[model samples]
Target: MQALRDISGRAGTLLTAMVFVLLLTAFPATAADAGYKAKPEPSSGDFDARKVIVDHVLDSYYWHLFDIADRSYSIHLPVILIYEGRFYVFLSSRFDHGKADYKGFAVAKEGSRKGRAIRVLADGRTPDPDAATIYDFSITRNVLSIFIASGLLCLLFIKVGKSYRDADIYATPKGLPLFFEPLITFVRDQIAILAIGPEKYHRFMPYLLTAFFFIFFNNLLGLLPIFPGGSNVTGNISVTFVLAMFTFFTAHWYANKTYWKHMFNMPGVPLFLKFPIPILPVIEIAGAFIKPFTLMIRLFANMTAGHMVILSLTSLIFVLGSVSVFLGYSISPITVLFLVFINFLKILVSFLQAYIFTLFSAFFFGMAVPKDSH
Candidate 1:
């Protein structure tokens, strides 16, 4: 329409065209249940053949791969689990999976084929399944990936800060940070500025940044159906809950004296109302905690739902097979096609979830650190 042409400008027109093109090319996939699915049976020999991947591999249906699983320029493995199932599942997020996709954690399972020892564990020599895998869960790929990412982020910030400190020296976003332009801008302008206001964004940027990339990277890697590092990053509600708790604490950490004063001692209150109905203060306090709690659940559920939808669709391929391969084969492409689409959407959602989480966290932090008046 003329309205759309005027609205998007030149870039918008191109983007709109791309959207139409992609959508036109896009195949329709049946709507199915959402979240990762683990199979109770075996699958093809290749790791990709499984339903999903991560710190542990579990059988599930849905999801797909474009470049590779748990890849970050040959950095981390796909975090996942294999639960003796007949399907493979994954999530799409901002992952930095490595090209050298090796395996880890094939602990004696009915479906896994054992390989040579990678390292010695407390139990003794253990098979790596991938043969090249080392250290086992000693580093715990997910945790290690997080730790490494944290370190890398810190180093990057330090470099940026140092550049600022030494005005003569010029250093640009060299590595991972380089890839993040719109992401950082979106976080800063839309997320931090809009949510927390400019004055207070810096105080909370640490937690927000940590959570943003952590979730983003982990989510992307999780999309692949493999092992030792996959979408399980957020699927493990505990992980999300913990991240939420971090935001909870960050928000509460610098709660100004006036903020707490208002919480405990509201102005213009009646005597009797102040006693029981004063529960608003308690409720208000709980709301503070609940914010992040909801954040955790929201991200976890959304990401899981994306995975599960694909899993269910993929499961159709196998489930219908009893009738005939024609049914499964006929449906498989449809399922996979949609799975890929949703998988791609998941990457955006992963970034978005991280942004929303960070934005809200920043808002909470701004609430925590306040001026005497506002």
Candidate 2:
């Protein structure tokens, strides 16, 4: 079962990658409707590897399809902003792929606020950083990638749930359930039950499963180099902060009296030490927040670092090509081989990170609710 699941998961991942490549080649031809142009220059640099790498990994208002023969193609996303009491809605294409401003709003193309949605003044200039009145609620690429992954999880689990409900004891599960069952059982037996204890694990299964798959899928999707898969949702600090918040609230919300007791008046500590100081309890409360803060940083740092490394390695080919054709040809093979290795390493890291995040969360939950009375 484990072997089959591994093969199936790998195949599914490969299929998703192929789909991305196809979308880049096939779908770009249609993206012209969304404002494809022969040449849309957003900068003056000939080859800025840092900018290129950073822009690809960061959220954008359009899904960049491809650039062939200096012709750029992109699918514009909705740009929603609230300014001064009025709501504004328009397709991001109005910004001309971040090349122009529209209706007193523009994409910040340079400076510290680069890649952000900004509001312009009556004379069409960016307002002072603190004085900007825009509240952007645009559906950027990262947001779209999240919605796609979410819909996928819903569909997969809904099918699996029905299978479990309808299947007989002797009948075997089929299709996606076959691929997911082993993973589900591993999380249940290896992670949840082992960390939280069997008696209390069941209550937390839903959260554990949801978080594990959400992180895992986003990590994998971020590794792809085309639209719909290139957005680094997992690496986004806002997303990680929200995930950590869920774990933090869950840990305290389900905490028992013993849990509170341990925090306020820890076992084996002197009663006199508790009074007059209250230092230990203060430390315990801070520790609670510190735990989730670590979760946010760990996932974001790992995912973002992996992406930076991969992009940097890939950029070498272009960076060299811009200098000299001979140098580019000489380095292409080595660069490609290194990139292949990095891609494989990224795949492994994706799964490992997902496991680590979920494991630590379960550990925190275990710490909060102990089954045995002291």
Candidate 3:
């Protein structure tokens, strides 16, 4: 059975690789036929690398696949807005790539309103800064990526769950199960059990697993330079904040009297320090909030910084190319090599960040659960 499973896995991997190569070969032709035109070379002094890099990394209302000349191939996401007690829904493309207005709303392109949906004035001359108050519920690229990753997670675990039930208890995982079981085990044994303690680890396994896989998968996906992949979902501060909040709530909710007492009233500290100053307890309480805050900022900063550096390197090629096509071509190989190295580093960092976040969460959980009753 082991031999057969290995053979099957190899066959499946080869087949997948072949399909991927075929897609790579065919995508250009299909894109050309679909009206994707070659993008124009950047003119020297006119090329703003900063703008290019920012647009690529930032969240957008549409998923830009590619461009040919002036023609762009993009997926227009839905735009939803709540204004003046009325709800408006439309396609993002209706904004004409941020050049035109849609109904009473238009994409903000300049000034303080950049990258936002603002209401056009009654006379339709300028954006109404006041009345443009909008509750944008639009599904931007980052939001779409989040949904996609979530759906993929559901499909993945559901299949794994089914396999667990159908396969013999002693049998090894064959396909997706084979690929993921080790990761699941690592999270369970190394992270949860070791950090959270075996007595309480089982209860937090589901949260730890969910967080580990979600962050890891999104980080991997963000490294891809293609549609449905490059949207910086995990790098977005809001997303990180929410994830951190989960840990914050879970830790505090499970915290025992000892946890609070240690935080609010230290046991061994001098009485004067505890009563008159109470500095240590105040600091400890602040630390409780700081733990999750650090978690949020740490993940957000690392992932965002990685994306910026990689994009900056790619932009260098273009920047040089703008000066002289030959110079750009000459540096292309070197730039690509650096880019590849960074990508490999990013992959390692992705796993490391996931592990760190999960381990830290477990540590916090353990801290909340007292080792012994006083």
RMSD of each: 11.1, 5.1, 4.5
- Over 4 Å off in model 3, which ranges? 1-45, 110-113, 122-125
lDDT of each: 0.54, 0.78, 0.79
How many clashes show up per model? 62, 0, 4
lDDT of 1 by residue, 121-167 (tens): 33433433433333322223445545655676677667755655665
TM-score of 3: 0.86
| Runs in model 2 lying further than 4 Å from the true structure | 1-45, 129-133
Pick by lDDT: 1 or 3, better one: 3
Per-residue accuracy of model 2 over 92-151 as CA lDDT, tens digit each: 999887668888778887876678778766655565455546787889888899999899
Better of 1 and 3 by TM-score: 3
Query: What TM-score would each prediction reach against the true structure?
Result: 0.60, 0.86, 0.86
Per-residue error (Å), model 3, residue 367: 1.4
Write the candidate numbers in order of decreasing TM-score. Answer: 3, 2, 1
The sequence of per-residue lDDT tens digits that candidate 3 reaches over residues 1-374 is 97897778766765685455334322222212111211323323445667765665677788878775666789999999998889999999998777778787887766665777888876544888678478999998899999999998999999998999889978756777776777899999999999978788887899999999999988877876676677777888889999999999999888888888888887876888788888888899889899999999999989988878877777777667667889988997887777777776777788899999899999989999877645
